[model samples]
Target chain A: MKKSSKKTGIALLLILAGVGVLILKGVSDTGVYYRTVSEVLIDSSLLEERGVRISGEVEGGTITYDQQELKLIFVVRDLEEVEKTMKVVYIGIKPDAFDADV
Target chain B: MVTLGNLSQSAAFMCSLLAMVLLLTGLMRNDLRFIEAGRRALTGVAVFASMAAFSLARLFMTDNFQVEYVASYSDRALPIFYKATSFWAGQKGSLLFWAWVLSIHVAMVAFNTRKETTRKNTPYIYLVLAAIVSFFFLLLITVSSPFEPLAYVPKDGNGLNPMLQNPGMIFHPPTLFLGYIGFTIPFAYAIASLISGKVDPDWLKKTRRWNILSWIFLTIGIILGGQWAYVELGWGGFWAWDPVENASFIPWLISTAFIHTSIIQERRNIMKVWNMSLIVLTFLTCIFGTYLVRSGILQSVHDFGATGLGGYFLVFMIVTAVGSIILIAESYGDLRTAHSLESLVSRESTFLFNNVILLAIAFSTFFGTIFPLISEVITGNKLTVGEPFFNMVNTPLFLLLLAITGLCPLISWRKASINNLKQNFMYPFGLASAGGGVMFGFGIREFYPLMAFTLSLFVSATIVLEFIGGARARKKLTGEPILLAFPKVIWKLRRRYGGYIVHFGVVLVVVGITGSTAFKLEKETTLQRGEVMNIGDYTLQYKDFNSFQDRNRTVYAATIGVVKDGKAMGDMFTERRYYINAKQPTTEVSVRMSLKEDLYLTMPMIGKNDEITIKAAVNPLLVWGWIGGTFMVVGGIMAIIPSRRRRLAV
Candidate 1:
């Protein structure tokens, strides 16, 4: 009984170790920095050569799209700090929920 | 004057509260009369909740703009079917629907267990279920009542969200809610067992069918939600790893673990503590998922706008968590297992590993879903973990799970000898390797796809081998034809074979997801009239543009002609709709589905220069996912059906 329990413990330890390694690798590989417009504006260098998603409200009537080139240029202002604004250039179809308020 | 809807809603809430009080008193005082009264009051709760739900449906059907819920989600121009389904399109109505379903389930449990033999655990079950039902009732009566009236009735109501007008929305929320509410039964039983100090396998046995039913509903609900996103959301793919999607998926992972671990408890009289904690965790995740979606703590397309009910949910979650831990800690001595693992390579060990992997996936998904909040609170930097994180983390884990699924049934219980493993695995292993080799020859060279295809093939071969070997043994023993013996074997071992069939279905689904994700081809182009764009053996030509009007929306449709390999296929028309009352524009994608692949088309925009921008994708093996989902549901149903063997054993 003791031998079998030891075996089980070793197996579990190995599995847990594998899981730990995978999780560490996964977190570093695909974690996206989420920033607000004001946060990004405060330190723009934080996003250098890294993928990030920023949450902000679109400035009304400041959105333009070039259908031929598939380019969308929009100005988004911080929800908490309305004075801070950023211009985003995206090249894809807009999401269905895209709006000035969102 | 109070409306019938208002009266019925209020009555349901009060009845649930009274029933909860009676049940709690009965459990505390060990009084059968109060327990009986509480059980009877549960019936009243069900009846009144149904009345409230029907009344809301009636309001929607009659286009009663006086009621806020009906007014917000329905308009005169909405179809009758959509109007009926709009019952769950908003927060208040969905909560009412959830409570109604929970009350009905509780009432059914009460009626089914009225026998004297099952009376011991009845009071605790009643207390747990009643407490849960009353929480929903509290929410209904206090913050988000569906029967709230508009101060002044408008002539017309704002229409339903245009994105929700599809057929998928009609079934998705209720199916998922059925799953979410269905877990309350097993959860109540688990807690009751702990509280009543009956930590035997009886509660597990009693709630087995309920557990399976909830699992099946959750599986179908998740698939249906993905299908809705794929077709209705105009995204080229399904399963974006969104927060709302993870909310549904997290409970599914925990429940899956619960189901498998409970099997160990039943078969070996082991892992009783593990089983109890898993059920508790499953129930907690379900409620936590609801809270996450409702509280808007995480931004998701599917969240109900932030409401006051978040505090109530948080308190309830904390109380339940603390209460469960205390009860379980006290009952730990009674919950000890008589049997332990005899070998590291045994069926029990396989199941344990499977549980670990499933829970690991759930943890990572839950963490990723809430990472932004965690980062914001801790480091003051919000960090979003996107699809890449989930796909990267989970794909290898799922592959491991599939390998275990292939290996578990072949391994003997308690201990498996090398000879036993060799005898079962040699042929399936060889066949899978050969299949992989053939695919490699066909130039399928990417690492993950190749691994996915190989693992899927391996699992499928294992299932087929199990069936064939069982049928052959049955034929030899019973002196019957192999084809006839197959059905007889399945009939005799329904639960075992039914699980094998579900695994087979999972194999198919994995294959479909792998093929669609890895081999999919997409092309986006702006084309003038009569101009052609070719992609993946199909040529699409911009034929014409047309416009039409319906009562609710103006639809601008673009007709595109399709020709594949010198043969002309039918014209596909995609629409850009402008809903009048909702003041929203929604894209209606056009898809031509076949056994091989789906040719999907969507028009993002129509330019002023008469150029149409079209996005076309060829998604391979997509239909197999739905087909496999059907197989899974059928297998689950077959497993739940009481076989003659079980009945005779009982």
Candidate 2:
């Protein structure tokens, strides 16, 4: 490569490297792993990971909302296996689409 | 009526297909007659497409329950405007709408390319447009036909989704579609340049207004969607980093990168290959974005159900990408840059860096959007990436982009000496430092927001300095009153100055985003009648809740009094509406917006005895986003206006 072209290449590589590092660091730092209730039921250690979003069917009649202090507790069962259930404790009000019958 | 619509659509499809064939054959045989016929066929396609579109809209207006699409998205009770917009609400209707808009664009291109200068390239350009229009019609007529008839006609159709009953539904979809379809014109021009081996800055200059026009539409559409979400969706926050949001945003990012780099190509006759790739990628990503929204491959709050259209969309995207890549490769020799970056301090380098940053952000967002699929394929687990991942990744990069927006104009072209850099950046840098110091004194010392605000002010400062410098120069040269020369200076150099205005507007938007996200406060409580709740120094007293019938729905509105610092700040109302045909109620959030903050309230739920739960929030500096959006649209208009060539005496 010509000297000038090589210099340009180095500059390009440096910027790309800097951006690559930023993206990788963010992925490791804030990327949330997701799990289904069945998987979590099999290995509870999944929840021990830094951040995990669990997918499940909210068991009917297991939702309780304390409107006074805005605490919510609910039981969600696996989509496929009803026996695999996880109780969740949340400290926020329900969003607009939080249907009680879900 | 359904038969007419179906026949018109079929005819439109045949016209586009015939246009493609004739245009290709005309090129091979060198027959102007055949190409002229092809161009006329394009006009025919537009006519038939419009007829079909009108037919479907007529079905909705007449409440024709015999049509499946109309039956699904409209009801007898919906208003006329909403019933009209229902033409593009569902998958079938949306595909038809895409074809309709695209056919109009094709017709515009065919009729407008009559000049001797443009005649040589019209055949290839028309062929590309015809091919694209044919693809949409292929999807529409075969898989997702709006003209499909129902087996049984019900008494009354299902109403439009209550969530879609807002004014946004009327405006957002069509505007976004215009943007999504507008990129095809530029893409077609690029393809024409490749096939004809006439790759130069000519196509770039010809399509500048088209690019800016489409970009403005996309910007407005996004801003309107955010407004809709904040007020109607009751999310309290404007953006959620959802898959559908990422779909539209990725193309915007790529197109933004193209808009910046194409200038370098135009002025310096370089980066031709990069500009080509960016435009082609932009158009393909528009298709990809539409696919993500329509295919339902990923779970999103949008809830566009999993259709069988994913494979077809995947095929289209791959086919276009491969075809464009082959053509670009064929013209690789012509696409070479005449010059390379002369120095790191050059404007060209800044454009390159800006492109890199933009593409990086787009790639990461695209990766995050399809992470579930990637994870499932790799690990047998559908791991969903969410808001935190996006925020962590994009925030710093966006801050970097903000910094570049300030730095790009400050640097001279090709190369700049240290003295020039010092002269240009000194004021912006000092202003940013002062901005940081002021915010720190106001106890606004949080890391991310502080950095964002400082960078935003820096960018704003550069733009302001450019304006002042230009106006002063004009004043000294003309020996006119400074006031008269200011506007004249802007008019003379409208394109550059207007771009600076847009940069200033972006700074406002960033400031708004940072302040609102960082300093947001929320409180929720169950309020009995005549009870009061306090959040963020504002006391909201619930006056009463009442229900009334409004047109097609029952509206439940809560009148609440707001008091701030011992002063009555008027009243705000939260509404919960139960559309008769909808399965659930929808919330109408009430917000009292000011320059400083937004006082937002939502009635999420009502229990027995009319005890209501109110979600209250104070989002600081939220109005700046909308105002900045206005400036962007206005500045974009100014930039796109054909600059008057009034010769400058200076």
Candidate 3:
């Protein structure tokens, strides 16, 4: 019984370890750095080829949308440093909440 | 004059606090009088909480612009049902609603006239439940009261969010609250059993129906939320892996694990420690989920944004987490089981494995939900993990869970002999391979999806085979007809059969998700007059776009003449409504739903050249998700009904 218990413990450990590895790999594969537009502007290429989620205020009058092509081009200004900006070209239906003036 | 809402809210708070003290005193001093007083105090708490809730509802119904919450979420122009629905429209009102629900559940427990068990441990139940109730009321009476009066009355109010004006919104939050708050009952019972040192299966057996009931409510809540997102939110897909969705889903997953492991405890009298932690964790995660949704820390389109009460919730979460941990630690020695697993290949071990997978998935989702915060703390940079991370980690784990779901019931109780394994394995294996072969023949090339479909088939076959096998055995024994024997067998083991039905429902949902996600076809284009959009064997010709005023809003809508299978299907209308009292417009998507596929249409924009841009998707087998949810609810309800043996024994 004791030996069987040990095996059960080891089996459980192995499963946890396997799942731990999967979580690590998944995080590494899909983790995107959430950054401000200022940070992205300061060092876009310095970062690795991973995705970056930039949080900023949209610059008014710099937004353009192609209804047919579903292309959106807008300049996102930094919340902290308003002068620092990044032009974002996104391809999707514009969300209902997204607006130029925050 | 003080409002009745405020007065009763305070009275409820006082009664709950008094109940907790009296119950604790009774527990310490062995005084039935104090315990009985504590129970009565809890009944008072329930009464006052209900009165508080009703008062708030009355305030909304009467369009009482003097109350801040009622004024904020209701208006004169809103309909009567929505005015009542405004009772839980915001944080403050929902807190009262939640408190009222918890109070009712507590009162039911206290009012139960079970003599022996009642005398022994119900004081702890009263203490624990009243403690939670008092905490909610403390927040209500002090920080975020729904009855907080405005300095001056207004003639009219700022209306409810146009997005929340849907019928789905009316039912979704309250149903979810019922589900979330329902966990508190079993949680309190578990704590009572622990503190009273009666860590028998009595608590488990008693709370079994409560667990199943709460699970059904939660299942319905989640399904309604998904349906709301699909139809109302104009997001063609149901689940988006948003933090708000994940928050609710995480608890559901944990509670599901808890519910399953509890069956083990009820039978084998083991996994008691695990069950205690799971129920405690379930309660804590419910609180955390509430915090996630109401705290406005996470970004969701649901828009129950940032509030001052979030800090209090965080403190409450920490307190409960620490307190439950301490209680579990205190009872650890009592909770240890005599029976250890004799073999890893037993039904017992499948539940353990199932738990491992479930917790892994839960942990992964929780981690993904809070990853940005963790990243910001560790690396000084916020890192976001989206659907890809969740899908990558969870898909394989879910498939493993699906496989275990198929194999768990068929395995022997303790350990399976090779012959028993062979008997169970042969048919499911052959059927699954045949199903996989058919799918491959039908050009299912993707590895994960093919595997998913095959495993879905395998799981389904096992569930069906269990029924057939049981019915056949019963028929052979009694010489009864197959149809009569089939239902009788199922009725005899209703709990297991109900579980099997739920599993079958889950299999259907998996097939639906796999089909919809893997084989979904979508089209986006600008269509002028008579321009046809070809998407997934259906063509939609652009008819006309019109702008008009409805009763309360300006409706900009487009009509599309749909054609499917060379037959002229009726025109589909997708509209955007601009409400008078709201800055934003709501999207109403058009869907032609079927068992096989759904043809969905949404128009987000129209061009100046009289052109309309339509987004359309052929979502395959998506309806089964809702169908499966209904089956799960029915099976869950079926499982909870008292069996004849138990009824006769009682």
Q: What C-alpha RMSD separates each model from the true structure?
A: 2.1, 2.6, 2.0
* Regions of candidate 2 where Cα sits further than 4 Å from its true position: A1-5, A69-73, A100-102, B116-118, B644-650
Candidate 1 regions exceeding 4 Å error are: A99-101, B24-29, B644-650
Candidate-wise lDDT, in order: 0.88, 0.88, 0.87
lDDT of 1 at B103: 92
Model 2 chain B poorest ten-residue lDDT run: B113-122
lDDT of 2 by residue, B348-371 (tens): 889998999899899989988888
lDDT of 1 at A99: 70
User: What is the lDDT, from 0 to 100, of the residue B71 in candidate 1?
Assistant: 87
Residue B83 deviation, candidate 1, in Å? Answer: 0.8
Judged by DockQ cut-offs, is candidate 2 incorrect, acceptable, medium or high?
medium
Query: What is candidate 3's TM-score against the reference?
Result: 0.97
Tens digits of per-residue lDDT, candidate 1, B1-650, equal 22776677678778877887887777778787888888888889899888888888888989989888888999999988999989999888899899999999998998888664236777888878888888898788878888889999989889888999999987899999999989999999999989989888999999999999999999889999989988988877889999989989999999988988899898889999898889999999999888987887887889897977888999999999999999999999999876788888999999999999999899888988888888789888666778888998899889999999998888989999999999999988998899999999999999888988898888988899899989999999999999899999998888888888888888888988988999999999999989999999999999999889987899999999999998999899999999987555888989998879999999988888578889999999988887888888888888898865435434
Q: Pick the candidate with the highest DockQ.
A: 3
Ranking by DockQ: 3, 1, 2
Q: How far off is each candidate at the interface, as Cα RMSD in Å? A: 1.5, 2.0, 1.3
lDDT of 3 by residue, B246-319 (tens): 88888899999998999898888889899999999999999998888778888876647998778989999998
DockQ of 3: 0.76
Residue B324, model 1: lDDT of 95
> Model 3 in CAPRI terms: which quality?
medium
